[model samples]
Target: MELADRVQSLTPSSTLAITSKAKALKDEGHDVIGLGAGEPDFNTPSYILDAAKEAMDHGQTKYTPSGGLVPLKNAIRGKFERDQNLSYTNSEIIVTTGAKHALYTLFQVLLNRGDEVIVPVPYWVSYPEQIKLAEGQPVYVKASEENSFKITPEQLEDSITSYTKAVIINSPSNPTGVLYTKEELQALGEVALKNNIFIVSDEIYEKLIYGQQSHQSIATISDDLKDITIIINGVSKSHAMTGWRIGYAAGNENIIKAMTNLASHATSNPTSIAQYAAIAAYSHDENEIEQMKLAFEERLNKLYNWITSIPNVSCVKPDGAFYLFPNFKNVVNHSSFDSVDEWVKQLLEEEKVAVVPGSGFGSEDNIRLSYATSLDNLEEAAKRIKRFVEKHSK
Candidate 1:
């Protein structure tokens, strides 16, 4: 059997691959401490679960509008108003199976053959693949560790071309946990506006911020930017509802309509019960989310200090999200290993610790460690990593 050229050319996710390998080792009775999982460690709040139960008991198991249920859309609208001070009508919102699906649909609707989408380095694993699936070229702009793994306005301006259709900005970014400041976003928004290009703002980690850092939507900078920005978000990360499949996109009504129409033939709608549950998630108190965020903050602080204390390992202290991207370039050079990949493999095989290599995120000098686990697990993983580095160092 033959696969499509596009499918054949796609790169499998390194995060998922490392996670699977860790799980396999665990199944084989190895005590593997895996730091590759991206979702929150908390369970979905009971109120949200109760809402789903009520929906099922009240017969909401049937299909909803392809775009989403009106109530859910209204809840999302309310969230935007309360959180970001941005308002969107129901027509501008379309809920999909997940934030990932919302993004894939956006690329499908927005891209034409050979169109370019400017993706920053150390991007979420799925962005480039989704662009390729939509027949769009991914133009990568490298964001150095010195810049907190964020692209400058100059870099953004330089990467634009006639074929550039959109630029993705992921704040509280997945692998790096780097948050772009409001001023930074304003500058980038200006670049996109001047170029007449679209901004795909993936704010799925918006609610997962820590310290004094805040998540700012590029769309909120101005009316002009809002008109051209598509905000991709969901309750998956915020409410520990990763399994709920209730992500949505908010932006231009025409683009939302096109994405909805595409979704109508594809997923039809996000799961009915999950949509109802998400309504409760958005409409209710956020105490649960606050608790989870605090827990993550605590774990992150400890893990950050621990990792940086290790010899020759340095990382930008993450401002938000539950991951720490630590550069091991010095360690790699001092160790017997030739590359970060081999170093990561040996750590997993010998110390029984699993982490995603930075090469997957377009950085070869670092590795991503997700603190979205128990503090105990994180501590143990750190110990194992420290020991491994000590043993291999020349």
Candidate 2:
């Protein structure tokens, strides 16, 4: 049987591959502590769940507009205005299956053959692969640990060429859990504005911030820049609604319309009940959000302290998000193990801990460990990692 040439260009997400292996061990009655998952461990908040239930009871289980229902769009608009200080009318917003889908749709709408997307190294596993699947090239602008895993405006400018179509900015970024400061975002925005390139800001973790700092969306900096920015956000991380799969994008009306048209022929609409749940999520109590933020902060502190205890492991304490992208280079090439993948595989096989290797995220010598598990499990996972590193560090 023949297969598409594109399939040869794609790789399975290493994060999910490790996750599946860990799940298989757990099913076989092993006590595997999985710290690889990217989603929050918390259940979807009760009010949001109740909203979904009520929607189902009220017979709201039909198809919706491909972009989203009018109320959800309006709620999303209000959210952007109140939170990010970016205003978007109904035509400028579209809700999709998840932020991933929102991004894939945007790539489909925007990319042509030979088009390039500048993605920083240590990127979310899907970004470059998705770009390839879209028939666009992903040009990675590598950032070092010295810069706290952030790509500079100069790097952004340098990566741009005549065929460069967009740059992806994942604030409170996925693997590194690094949040770009307002100054940095503005600087990058300046480059995008100058080059007349689109900026796809993945602000999915905006509501999950840990410290005193708040999220500053790039589009909010200026109306002039807003037209070229696509803000991808969702309820998955913040509200612990990964299964609900409700995500949205706000940007220029033309792009939104294109994404919606693409979605209509693809997904038709995001789940109707989930959309209703998202309405509650966007309009829910501030207190619930505050409580979740506090809990995440506590977990972040626990993981940060524990990571430092590992002999050669060091991590940046993220201002937001539930991940700690620790550098284990000292143990990587120096280890008895051949590669980071081998080290992680041995740990999963021996210590019963599951973590995604940094190589999977474009950083070969580092690894990402999520603290979105239970407090007890986080403690155990950290303990296992520390032991593994110490034994392998020679």
Candidate 3:
């Protein structure tokens, strides 16, 4: 059998592969601990779940609008105003299956065959792959560990060319959990505006922040840049509704309409019940979210302290997001294994702990360790990881 050339050239997700391997080991009677997943371990809030149940009971299961239901869109608009301090109309938003799908649709709608997108190194694993799948070129700009795994405006400007179509920014980023400050975003937004490049801001982890730093969308930093920026968010991470698969994006009216048209042909609309649940998520009690945030904060502090105790492994102590991207190069240099991929494989085999290699996120000699698990599981995983480093480091 023959497959399309596009599909043939793609690589499966490394994170999911690690997760599957861990589950397989567990099934075979091994005590494998998984720290490779990107979702919050918390269950969906009861109010959101109740809303879904209510939607089902009311027989609102039929097909909705091709974009999304008006109520959900309105809810999303309200969220932008209340949270991000950015306002948008219903027509300016497009709801998709997930933030991943919102990004996929944005790439497909905006990129042409030879267009180039500037992506920072150690980015979310899906960014470059989705760009490739859309027939656009992904140009990677490297950022050093000293910079907290974030790219500067100078770095971003150095990567631009006539063919540059967009720059993708993820704050409280996956794999790194690094959040860009308002000053940094304003500087980058200026560069994007001057160059006429679109900015794709992935703010999925906005609500998961800790410490004195706050999450700021690039669009909120500048008015001139607003029309060119596409802001992607979802209730998955913030509300712990990953399985529901509901996400939305706000952008220029034309771009949102174009993305909606693309979404119409692709998935029609996101799940109806999920959309209803998402509306509740956007409008739910703030105290419930605060409780969830506090729990994550407790777990994050525990994991950070445990990880810092291990020699030769240093992390940024991110302000947002539930991940710790530690630089493992001191222990597992390139010469230690054939590649980061092999290093991760050997670590998984030897320690029975799952982590995603940095290669998947456009870097080497690092690994993304998610803290989105139970405190007990995290403590145990940290012990195993520390032992693995001690045994492997030269």
TM-score of each: 0.99, 0.98, 0.97
The TM-score of predicted model 2 comes to 0.98
Query: Can you tell me which runs of candidate 3 are displaced by over 4 Å?
Result: 333-338
lDDT tens digits, residues 1-394, model 2? 9889888879899989999999999999999999999888878889999999999999999999999999999999888878867777899899999999999999999999889999999899999988998899999999888899999998998889999999999988888878888899999999999999999999999888876777888888888778889989998998888999999998988999999999999999999999999999999776877787788889999889988887767777787888888887777766888887788899999899998999988999888888888889999888888787777776
Q: Give the CA lDDT, 0 to 100, for residue 133 in model 3.
A: 90
Candidate 3 least-lDDT 10 residues: 330-339
Give a tens-digit lDDT track for model 3, residues 258-358.
99999889997899999999999988777877777888888889998998888877777878888888877766662367676787898789999999998
lDDT of 1 at 30: 99
Displacement of the residue 297 alpha carbon in candidate 3, Å: 1.8
- Stretch of 10 with least lDDT, candidate 1: 211-220
Go through the candidates in order and give the C-alpha RMSD of each one to the true structure: 0.7, 1.1, 1.4
After the best TM-score superposition of candidate 2, give how far the Cα of residue 275 lies from its true spot, in angstroms.
0.6
In model 1, the number of clashes is 0
Error of 2 at 379 (Å): 1.1
Cα distance off (Å), candidate 3, residue 171: 0.6
Best candidate according to lDDT = 1
Best first by TM-score, ranked: 1, 2, 3
